[model samples]
Target chain A: MTMHPDVAVLARYADGDPGLDEASVWSVESHLETCADCRARLAGQIPDDTRALLDVVGAAVGRGIEAGPAPARRRMAIRRRRLAVTPAPWLTMTAGVLGCAVLLHAIAPDLPSLVLLLAPVAPLPGVAASWNRRTDPAWELVAGTPSAGLGMLLRRTTAVLAVVIPLLALAGARTGAPLAMLLTPCLAFTAASIALGSLIGVRRAAAGLGTVWSVAVVAPSLATAQLPVVLTPGGAAAWAAAAVGMAGFAAARADLFRRLNSAD
Target chain B: MRTISAAETAPATYAWAVHAEQLKVRAGRHLAVDGLDLRLRTGVHGLLGPNGAGKTTLMRALATVLKTAGGELTLLGEPVSGRGDLRRVRRELGYLPQDFGFYPRFTVREFVEYMAWLKEMPKASIPAAAQRAVERVGLTAKADAKMKTLSGGMVRRAGIAQAIVNDPQVLLLDEPTVGLDPEQRLDFRELLADIGVDSCVLVSTHLVEDVVAACTDVVLVNEGKLVFQGSPEALMAHGEQGDPGFSPAERGYSALLRRHRGGAA
Candidate 1:
């Protein structure tokens, strides 16, 4: 037969003393589980007041377990919280607007595929949506948090692109536009907006870049029925360079995002 | 490995939870918190001011939501400068904004738990800490209720739950009792009193009675500058014998604001 715990160890374990090692405490608890005499010894070591509090807490916990919500419902609630990281309203609205533009392309096949021409700027609104304080209801609370800077903004921007990129790809596939023409410029503009966003504001940068693309490329290309030089295969290298340079700029000035106020 | 408690990491023996030296924060072009130097320790201090007097701006700056345009601000002995310092300070901060926005679909408990995660609380401690905060705010029954379904007062309480979930060293609540009913307001004041004993709690409010009941000191601001900082009794002494208001505290509040406004004009 194994030996019982010493009186001193039992007393220290009962008192939850800092010096008591986990192995000794575990041994004492294991012994008490099977040995009635040791259990009695452990109980005697606990003060009456402490025992009374334990009884009260134990009874309350028992009652609570009986009355608590079912585990299934609790799990569902947890699952909902886990899945609650959906895109903001502005992002949803951007997708909706882009969907309408795609519909416009479908109706007018004779006209140039607005989807390909517009691909560069399609994700801009959604990217802006990810960081816009005025539009987000939880902005005040979220802005005050430690992680409420470029890292979080970029994460949300990635989420927006994750959804928007596939949509743009589908639009390009349907319209028979070259993938590089649509994809490279799209990434370049996104990077440009983010880089400039660090200087001004994300919302302002998106709106400004979107307007410039529309005027400089979309309108001219639409007028002549010829693809803009910037969207041509020959231009892919330039687009790639702009994207890399702007991305570097955005990373360098990431700290600016933290000081961006809603009022600004 | 011994798990260190939050108390050990953030010792309470520090001199001031908030220390601002000539802190200048701008809202637009105007300086909202202009050259304001103040020190706050661990206790409930009421911030009394009129509209547009920079109460919200000061709270926002302290919460690290708005950056200081000029001067120095330190939170919990950590200087509020550079990215690393800001992150360290934010880990120990809890703020309830004036608007207190939320996602309508998030359950009350989810909102608090999300805030705990944002404060960088350990993943294992978050669920239990969030639950305790919800219970403390008397929202146990509605823990599963979606935020949109809650009444204004309930949402306010939800906001309160999130602020305290981290057991922050510096807790800032701007107009926290606005939507709450009289009974809820009383309960909220008690919660403030309880937390005020340990942490530095600065509550900005228009309600004079709430401050008189719960605050150890009153800081009156007017036109983006400190008018007075003293005990409630000292503020009460400012009221004239024949001043017309609901209570002596209200009269004192009115008298002081009026006097400050007069002097500023």
Candidate 2:
């Protein structure tokens, strides 16, 4: 008695028969046309081992096709989502600092009258430190991905500045200083401090390093002159631009370092 | 060369479902899993070790949650250390960390659904899949209950439920039956047996009975090295030489005596 073509084909595949060629394929196809049980059996005989291997290859191909634009899109989504949900620690810290500065302005209407003017800059360090600690883990995880680290850093820094710079402006107005003059130095210093703080924290430094550094820069200037000559409009603007540029560079490098480490 | 028959042609596939070579991990200065090589095939494989024996560390490396310091590891034929390999392999992998934490406010269903999402199951299919997993683990009644409201045993069952929610090809359960009572443990063993049909299930615990009842193979890792790998019967046979009074028995009183003597020996 002759076996069904489907059974023969499946037997050939299962029994390590090496002669399966166009004839065997045709025989199996014809057998499947009429035989449901044999077809089902043939389906089961496809070797799950081979199927699993194919699945892995298929999955890899699918991922390769999808991986390119995905990180960029995910990065943007994460940035937007983080911006929406991130607890504005900087805002709270800035508010606390502004409150302290306003209280001091009220208590000591100083000799230069602009002594209360530099109080906003004093809180820059604290705000920078808080932001660094709050955002570092998230930034590190993002950096591990193929996302643009600078893009994410800029988004976070912009979000922080959005909240902090305006509060400093309000403080400047209250201190009887020009909004532009107060804003320039405060923004410049805050931006620079954030860049430095983020870089230091990524290197696993102890917390408050940024605050100490920022204080070192500002404290000496404050003790020497009520409003230093560098606090002038053109000088402050130049410092702010330079600070922003440096922050951009630091954020990019920090991201690159994290990615390289993760890859290794 | 003589050609072998297909049935006799030793399976070209069915290689180690998990293979790790020279796996190294460090926590501060302490080496967690050090230069360990491991291979697991089908059936329930029990990982036996005392606490801090690097069992959990090894499990985490296999689960792809923790990266190894030095190793070439493969899961289901894919290099585990590769960027997207975890996500891909994780689709067919189920892991229950020893100390599982869930969002306290989430319902059991919600938690499992979240896991399904993380496992990359289709969103549309997650609800039914979660329901099936809950039912399989006998948690259908507690499906809507808040995770925090569940008892410790129920929480453990829920964790197992989530791990197997995707019907993974590789199921890694870390102390899966820790908080369960006898009846629940039996029920869990039945569930594991049912799921082990087309998948490789591994449960890590020091409990010998758990291995004896559920696992076809037992692996004992002592101080980050594989000390033994074989069937429970083989392990019992090894121990029998040292203890002449020990004898294997069927269930109930006789089995209890054998276990006691084995322990005392």
Candidate 3:
């Protein structure tokens, strides 16, 4: 049997006195947790002010426990919130642009395959989304992390492709654009942006590519109402080779992504 | 491997967790941090300077967000110029920007954990580490609250929480007390002392008193140049009755800045 705390010690403990020492206080508290009689005796020894404070705190805690969410439910809530994070908004925006392109092509089949013209740059937004310091609020924090290098960029870029490719394929199917032409150009532009992005930054690279593509391909195609030679099977093959070349170039210069102040 | 932790690698004055010599960093075309030499060890260091003095730029350079345009920069005994060394150094570094952004929808716990993951902490240890960090910042109750729901001070605390989530060896915080109330700033001082036991903490702020109260040493910079480096008491020593400030530290700060400006002029 353990010895109970003496009357004097119980009184000192109830007063919240530090003179009792941490060891003595710890022992008394541990004993009181298991010994109801000690608690009962200590309850009488507790100062009235302290007792009132305890009642208020205990009541508040009890009420809080009753009203608060269950641990399981809270976990589920966090899981749901995590889904809407990172690249989803960018992915959705890209999807919207593709949708517009598909609708435009359907309304005006003579207007030179908008889907085909725009497919190459479809993944650019999402690919560049996570890397931009200006647009991304968490850029500084993310940049400080160890894994925030070329590997992370590639993973995010791949995720963008996973969502975009399917959407591009759907748009192509609707607009009657060939799969090779639609998908190949998409790969070429994404690779080129990332390659050039290694030097200028991903967001800038994407924007530059998008602008040039619109000027050289989309705008001209719209003006003349004719799909350029770049939209052909031979052109698609050329884009594929360019995709491989640009990807290789990006890989060779992976060292650039590891540096700071590249305006990332 | 045993000898790698030896104290001899660094110069006699403390182990330099962050060391910069003649370092130049660019902010666009401007050289914000120019030819500055500084050494930091395992203690809370207060970085003090006037506006545009390059305190934030220096902090950014230390955080490795900006490349050193020239000179030498070493973190935890390794030169920061190497490619492979960056990842290892980054894992040991923590930074809170002057004005940070958060994913509004993420809960405080989620954000910290995400940062831990980004720092590449082991999967199993992330949750516990993140929780400990949140608790340290006194945000246990608000751990589940979304970032957008937090007040400004709470957001600042959340930023500090994420910065310390990995228990970084080199923690850089710029203007951390900008939004904090007096009481919260007091808590932050205690947290800084606790963390500074083994880590090198560099806190940049306009609040001179906060520096004098919490920091082991004061570093005053002007125009990308290091003007002063010494103990807080030494900083107070520079102040005279005529110097402008409410407290000794503030007067000392004014005196140092005045002297530096006078010299430059």
Candidate 4:
């Protein structure tokens, strides 16, 4: 309170003139932050037209905030909303697909890693649909939202994987594949798809990675009736490292989804 | 090129809800909105254009759905070129795309409330705001009905409800009245007039009557360029001469496009 800005300086700030130096403006703003009197004086200097517009907007927003249902009820409603839109149908179908893999392993006990092959790929389709704007009916609305970036996509992907992963674990238990073989490679592929999906769309990334896995590992393993090096215990550590690395890569490119084209 | 710092309480000269300068937008490889300049204040501004004239693309750019190919665009005083700025602008903006989509399983109320949340509305304020918006669109009775059960017109109304649920500072609706009946269209017009009192509302449509009835101003675009921007009277003035359309407004619209195309040729 020892010193105050000049009236002329306050007036210049009020009018939005470009003549005021940035340093002086910053000093005045910093001073005003601690000075209620200056703040009031500055508010008084706002143009009548702008003040009126602000008043109208303020009233509308005030009414909006004051209104609405009770918070507890709203929280419950939001929970129900999340439950309703959680892509349960697709997850259920994925479980059915996993069930088929389990049945295939039981029928051909000697078949080369039937469940192991299916386990890694089972979550791909569901994970792909979980975040792909094209597959979701509400994609237009969801994609345009402020939360439409990688955070939202990761949330949906996790939800899809949550359902599919456990099913894969159960399938591996039936097929006699090592737990490390089923879980690590499955997570690795999911993370890799998302990492690549950050550049291309998730659907294309899933399809491409799925095709590569089928050709590189699944096809070779079946032909030779021997476990691939990458699917063995030693490869588990590599898969674990890849999952962390790919997830980190996906997080770094989060902004890519924000500006993604609608068709993507 | 005036700059208003975040800390300054200065009143800007433009005071526009949306401002674009030589903005270029693309749909795939083709330029949709090419070198377009537009400024809108607080009012219902109707956007009139033919198919592929870039109205949707312009709307999408404004809504932050599509990236600008070139030039500058601002919404609610925030430049949309930056990710942070676009996120802040989107919080205060509402948009209903032409092909508005929704989850079939979500009830009407849940859908609107979810949109409010996505727009970052306060959790407590969401239910009432959503209820009011639903009631405004005459969907109070069906608030709890799943989205898939609603007919086409009802679905469109639901779309409108979500757009206005947050009482956004800038509301953009693309072909909002497409499936609405005559009576419903009238109701929608009245809603536009009511909301236009404070917020900047832009409606993009092929229908001229809606523009004449609700919009304070009309912008006509063709071939990704603005043909005219003025009052409906000025537009109708152009059609005063021997014209072939049914209504004066329609004739005016047709005449303006023909004149622009002729000039381009």
Candidate 5:
């Protein structure tokens, strides 16, 4: 039968006295883990001030939850980051549209390039949904938050791109379409949407741009059965310039998101 | 006469966390908060007004959700007119709009933690702070439940929990007691008093008794103007015998509204 440590030895252990032998310290700590009676006795040995100090330390430890994130917490944080960035139906729309274009390409060879025609407008719904008051529902609260300005907008836009770009790559591969035709136009449209979003609301700008692209460009190319000038290989530079310029303009006019009218 | 130096007057000038002078904010085309001058320091201040009295607009402006249309407004000693000051000011600000929306899929704890993240709280402390906030609003049991599953009152408490999660310097709640039950309202008042100790909390509501019970000061507004601002005791003193309200404070509110309209006309 195991014997309990003497009260005098327990008191010294509680004090963390240097005189207390090392073997005794380890044995007491290990025993206390399994023995509730010994723990209570040791607690009785601690002075009030010492107990108070220990309590403070314990509380502070509780409050931090992480000085350094554990592996499980890191996994949870990565999941949370994904959820926080894209917690809406926008991604579904982006991917679905691309899939439809791919299927339509296989089903209708006479249509020439449904995949190419729709590429420019593919990310519009996504970019719009990222910060729109209607879709997010937390618009007013998010607008009033510290990270609500251009940085947050860009972060969400980038997340949308992160999801949409890969979908575009897959769509391009599936349709035997040129990668540049699929990518640069969508990037251009996304940038233009954000640029004009600062002037109007994001949702409004996206809707307007998508309609304009369909009417002014997509419809004409479809009717003529020839690729539009902008969709041609040589037109990629203009698309790239348009992308950069619009992005710069959007950054410069970042204040628009802060206004009540343009908050969406 | 000696002129007051900038250094000497600075203490008085910086005392207010929210200061507005001739501030104007338009809701759509109409000027909702027009030519209003107000100042608030630490402690709870209840904003009482009629439905179209621009109370929500005023709260929206103080929360930095609406830009100032025409005058000077400062928050935490920073002017609202400049874009540079917004991030700094917003870090110390918390707001609950009259009608707020959430992701619905987020759990109570996750929502509060998300709000803390939006406010840029230290990453390590978010979990503890969110837990504490959920407890403070008495939603510990529902902490893991999805927001869509919560009752209206529980959702309101969750909103309160998120507002306090960051321990902001200036807190704004518009019509916060609308959906809370009687008992929950009492608990919310206690929570407000607790938060108001170190932060400037502005609560805009139509419930006069709540103002009387929980507020250190009462502010009355009409047609985008400050009609009255004083202690609850002082507001009760303004009450006349036959005013059209159930309690002394409500009656005082009615009398003041009448007096203001009469004076304006």
Candidate 6:
């Protein structure tokens, strides 16, 4: 019976018999077309050798694969999913501060110091970002999801804004400016703080960066300036314009968080 | 391309515990699983292969933990693409990952119960369900012990207990008996055989006797592709003489020896 060249080639390949090359491979392919028995032999032997070798190796590394629990990918996914659902305790603290903003307005008739209102805004964004750092996996998952990162950040920022803006309006009304007029400095400071915090967090900067930014800018601006005198009609309008500018900056910071987490 | 409208549905009839077609997975530069097709049904199915052969990757895919880069994959007849479908299928699915760990602080019962919760079992039924699984794995006495306190074998038993807690329809155990003693290994094989009656159990291991003893079928994967799939006897018989002969003395019996770790083939 004529042996298939394919089987002969495989045998030669297995034994590492010399003088077999591309031409030999082609010749075997041609022979396999005409011979069935040799083809069967070649088909059977090749896999047998491969499997025998693999069985040996698999036995060796089997122990390591067994002992290592929790692969990195699964851990990351779980982290991200948990973060998306659970808010940090700091968020609750911020909510408490918002509550205080409301209570302070009712209890003391005179407009509370701008320092008190703007003080919370300065650290709030950084604190929120720090909480996010502790739960990086959760943020990474959210960043991976179909939802836009900007949208998620904006949603968070908007939530804070909802609490702060109303309290600021109440304080603004007590300070004798138009409701929209009172929004300028408070909104600017809030936006600037959120923007600065988000930026520092994205750059992997330390938490103190936000505090430093707050001390350097807001502390000085509030101490030397006479707020009631500065709240003339044109000044209020200018403040409103500045607040709108800062909101734009906050939107950009949100975008940066989305990109960083998505890259992960 | 023709746009086909509804009402032309031809439902699938295969009794597959896991069926996947043209599955693909890419991690960084390596293609872990590429253009793979698989069908696992009834009995214990052993997945055998070398390192980086994609056996673990395929198991993870079947568990619905890793998203396929391409292809149609289903677990227990439900498509694994959507979250809702995955959740429904996951209720019947049990997965023991290759490297599985528990919270060190959790007692054995708590760890298993926590897994049951992840499977979305009812709160009231979790305790009974966890108890049943612990009994099945012979870990009932250790149920109160913290995971950190358990030996390696005990930890593996705990992992098996958690996987089978819900009495899953499709169970994927990646190297289930890894750290077990010979007696424990035999007990695990028996446990798997008993559970294989109604559910499809897939065991990925390098051990051939595990397949010979417990599995009704075997699939050998090599380098991201399937090399062979058949019954253990059929695999042994592939190139044998009349009656597909198997001798106790042959190196081929090494397949079984490797599986049982030098035990009786």
In order, what lDDT does every prediction score?
Answer: 0.83, 0.64, 0.86, 0.83, 0.86, 0.63
Off by over 4 Å in 1: A1-112, A262-264, B1-13, B81-85
User: For candidate 6, what is the DockQ-based docking class?
Assistant: incorrect
lDDT of 5 by residue, B28-134 (tens): 89999999999999999999999999999999989998877899999988898656548878888889998899877788888888888888888888888899999
Give the best candidate by DockQ.
5
Can you write out model 6's per-residue Cα lDDT over B1-265, one digit (the tens) per residue?
A: 2232342234435568688888886644678888888888878888887678898878876776665778888777777743343456667778787776455766888778767765777767777888888988898889889889999999899888878887787888998878999999999989999988867999999776677788888887766766668887776754434222255212333453244333322
Residue by residue across B18-82, what tens digits does model 4's lDDT show? Answer: 99989999988999999998999989999999888999999988888888899998887778855
- What's the C-alpha lDDT at position B14 in model 1? 57
Select the stronger candidate by lDDT from 1 and 5. Answer: 5
lDDT of residue B116 for candidate 1: 86
Model 1 lDDT, residue B169, Cα: 78
Clashing pairs in 3: none
Once superposed on the true structure, which residue ranges of model 3 sit more than 4 Å away at CA? Answer: A1-90, B1-14, B82-84
In terms of lDDT, the poorest run of 10 residues in model 1 chain B is B1-10
lDDT string, candidate 1, A80-157, tens digits: 343225454655676676677678878877767787788899888778776777666778887777877878777777
User: In candidate 1, which residue pairs get closer than 3 Å at backbone N, Cα or C atoms, i.e. clash?
Assistant: none
- Lowest summed lDDT across 10 adjacent residues in model 5 chain A is found at A73-82
Which residue pairs collide in model 5, if any?
Answer: none
Over the stretch B8-126, how does candidate 3's per-residue lDDT look in tens digits? 34453436888889999888799998899999988999999999999998998899877788999999878884455488788888899998888898889989988888888777778
Q: A164 in model 1: Cα distance from truth in Å? A: 1.0
Q: What tens digits encode model 3's per-residue C-alpha lDDT throughout A44-139?
A: 988889889999999999999999987763244332343346778889998999899988877887888888888888898887775677656787
Q: Whole-model lDDT, candidate 2?
A: 0.64
lDDT of 2 by residue, B1-265 (tens): 2233464334535488888888886544678887778888777898876567789878867776555678788888788654442455667788887877665666888778766765667766777888899998999999989888999999999988888887777899888988999999999888878877667888998677777888888777655666667787777655533443234411222333345446546
RMSD to truth, every model: 6.9, 13.3, 9.3, 11.2, 9.8, 24.0
> Please, what are the lDDT tens digits per residue for candidate 1 over residues B127-220?
8899999998999999999999999999999999999988887999999998899999889988999988778999999988889999998999
